[model samples]
Target: MTGYLPVVGAAMSITEYDQHRDWILEKQRDLELQDFITADVLNGNWEHLAEEVLAKLDGYTGRLGIHGPFWNLDISAADPEIRQIVQKRLDQGLDVCRKLKATHMVVHSPYTTWDQHNLDQYDQGHSFKLQCIQENLGAVVAKAEDIGCTLMIENIEDVDPSIRVELVKSFNSNAIAVSLDTGHAYYAHGSTGAPPVDYYVKAAGPLLQHVHLQDADGYADRHWAIGDGTLQWPALFNALQKYTNHPRLILELANNANLPKSMRYLSEQGLAQ
Candidate 1:
């Protein structure tokens, strides 16, 4: 796998997709749609939006997915009512996936820095959290399986990298898998005393089915272009070679205009296309 340039792609909003339509369609690169991540889009009548997107993507053929709604929606909430809302939001995301024929949806991880420190203090604490997650996502997972979409649990505020890997494994379903966010992992490393970004790739191994490739300073989720931050792109790409999963490496940047710069940085380093 030495000198391997993995299949790289972009996670773009509908407008961004249109802006880069020619380049994306020319390369036939993989894509993760980001329009449905907002609450307004989820709560509104989005069928027309979906139809418009389908129309725009008429000639494109590539691996397609979407960033699911994760705003203030906790999939591991202890309260049944909160969990119901979370489930409803996720079900809506799946409906979008079904409409677009997407095969993956990126979801936020439930683990936190507090869970890293306190989950072991009580014997039931860890089990109870797992129970809550299972209860909340059981139906959603089944729907994902039925619709041929894998729900990728992405790391956010997670100090322990393996926590998400274990959580994904606990589901025992193919529809659930791990998703790594480079900026989020770097934040944990610099701000929370966790391991570096590459360790996360190693930890998730084959379970990592998707990735949000962003560069950051380890202070916040900067979502900058690949060379604009302090992350070790070479090391992370080196670690990625150990897995056979060939995960979807989607550039999830803050500014869609910087997509070319990001890809240029990776290509110059011989890391990705």
Candidate 2:
């Protein structure tokens, strides 16, 4: 785990099961990847497609992970009923993970209408609203564990690290963990290296399950090629390597985390195994 880095996998091509089956399997073996990532919807033959891919990987003993659906999912909803609906959407990916025997489920904790950026707009009930949001997220964590799958909280650039840290602390579930993103973390802070990736790594160390690797201009998520921009891969890897579990790296390049470009960049940078 320390010496050799794992090959990265792509999100399913075009959300189709049949089209991606052969390619995913081939990538798994050819690239020596135990981890395959997908942002595929839970419906529309996703399960069957996953089965086909898993069957192929079963030959090579590959592990699977999923990027849960993002549309309309509100894990931090202030309303209890709305939060339940969001939980169902997230559970879809977890359920599929069970069928495919996926090792982890990567998820996004995105913005709500009452975005924290607009905190000044809050009236007298701001404190109460924030409490509701936290409680619902905690509940989601419990529900994720009940279903017997790991829920990796995806990182976002704009949200405060304290929010993520608090969620991890309060959720306190074995199934709950983090899906750190290098680019997102970089852009999340207002200034370059203001809150270093190393800081978040240590804070979320216990919940660290996997990672999304990319580079950006520190203002937007450009998803640049490795080392093409300013992302510090060597230092990032150095910090990550200090951890006990060798977290799988997902080369989250543009469109999809394609293996071809990922391999090329890593090879050029002497990062390929």
Candidate 3:
């Protein structure tokens, strides 16, 4: 908590939270919510579980974040109708964040190689895509600002950092920032031929707000705990030190049970105290 905002993923449901409550309470860590908790926001299926979840977290005194719904929901959809749906879902997610008193929310960038190709062949295709993102996200950020929340747009299938940087900078809103997932970046490095993971942190620089700290082989998004897979952590952290003063660091492991192992690895490496 000294140099970064360290948090653990509170698994999707209250049931899952019960399983990890002991360890979470013992460690006194903050939380980054799993996608399941907010999945209903996309379909307008509110389970009214926020009050229940808040009750369970009564004693926690750390910051909270939610991984917003992104399953088949593209905010930058070219279709106006689809974009409207995207806005509705994100607005619901923002309402949830406000209810939970969570300042940071993680949202996915809708950029993909396929989309890029489709967007091409038209004059100012890239500009059109940027406009789509800016127009949609600009409205979303207005709501986020109303709720006093910041949306951290994460790279999903990004082939490079520049586009993602541009997407965030286009909004130019304090409520919009970037979230770097190390595992995703590592997997993208091989799968999409993206720059090294550290380059992303450096590129995002001051705009970097949240980080999903996990490891993965270049082949797939294994989400293995740090050090369990090959990632240049020393170099990544060294580069990160200059960019953010206290970015939220969530150990976004595939299996929440590995939180201890991941936390221990960071501590043992003197990256976290």
Candidate 4:
């Protein structure tokens, strides 16, 4: 805390954001709007939602981002038809970002535990996956670049962290970067035999630009408050100090009411302001 006071942010829906708008605007904390992560919202009258967000967020100044549509949309689909659908969904998400003036969008990683065990079993297996990613997301990445949005690839069931780092690097664009979800990493550590959460920070290093700072019991993605779970916050912060990128540490809790409790815990621990 002496050398750096990490900026703490939160991920919430429009309703939740409005409920806590006072606290959020008072501090001008970085925010990741979660309302654009589903198909229903993406297909519905999202323009109205954008207008509402813009009106509510008026006079507030902080880093704004959104959780892009990810449900049932795989960015590495091998089928051309499926890839087109995926591309459409993601492009729709970018449209939301464009309307909201969001600078970042969280996207789920395509790598899974199965890929870790079997990706190298065949010749050019990993390379083929990369090709599929390029085919599916090439245009989307270009669009993101135009809209001044960075796509953060978040780990879900990934066991090998370096695999995503490699994927982010493959695009070779500033709009593509790494996003670490703490609870997911902890689940991978305890349930999927992945390395500890701190290892993920070290692995991503400077490429890491966003973080979902939820707590878990190392068994599942609990999304609990900070002190309520078994994650090592100090170790995670220590590892984060190695890079000067100052990644956005967002508290992506399941219950937004517990945001105050989580902030209190981090403040008490001196991990974040």
Best by lDDT: 4
By TM-score, the best candidate is: 4
Top-down TM-score ranking: 4, 1, 3, 2
| Cα lDDT of model 2 by residue, 198-255, tens digit | 6667667656767777777777777776766676666676676567776666666674
Q: lDDT score of model 4?
A: 0.92
- Which portions of model 4 show Cα errors greater than 4 Å? none
Q: Which ten residues in a row have the lowest lDDT in candidate 3?
A: 5-14
Q: After superposition, how far is residue 198 of candidate 3 from its true place, in Å?
A: 0.5
Q: Write the per-residue lDDT of candidate 4 for residues 149-170, one digit (tens) a residue.
A: 9999999999988888999999
Residue-by-residue lDDT tens digits, candidate 1, 161-250: 888888999989999999999999999999999999999999999999898999999999999999999999989999998878899999
Give the number of colliding residue pairs in candidate 4. Answer: 0
| Per-model TM against the reference | 0.97, 0.74, 0.89, 0.98
Instruction: Indicate the TM-score of model 1.
Output: 0.97
RMSD values, in order shown: 1.1, 5.0, 2.9, 0.9
**How many residue-pair clashes does candidate 2 contain?**
1
Question: Which residue pairs collide in model 1, if any?
Answer: none
- What is the Å distance of residue 211 in model 2 from its true position? 0.5
Q: In order, how many clashes per candidate?
A: 0, 1, 0, 0
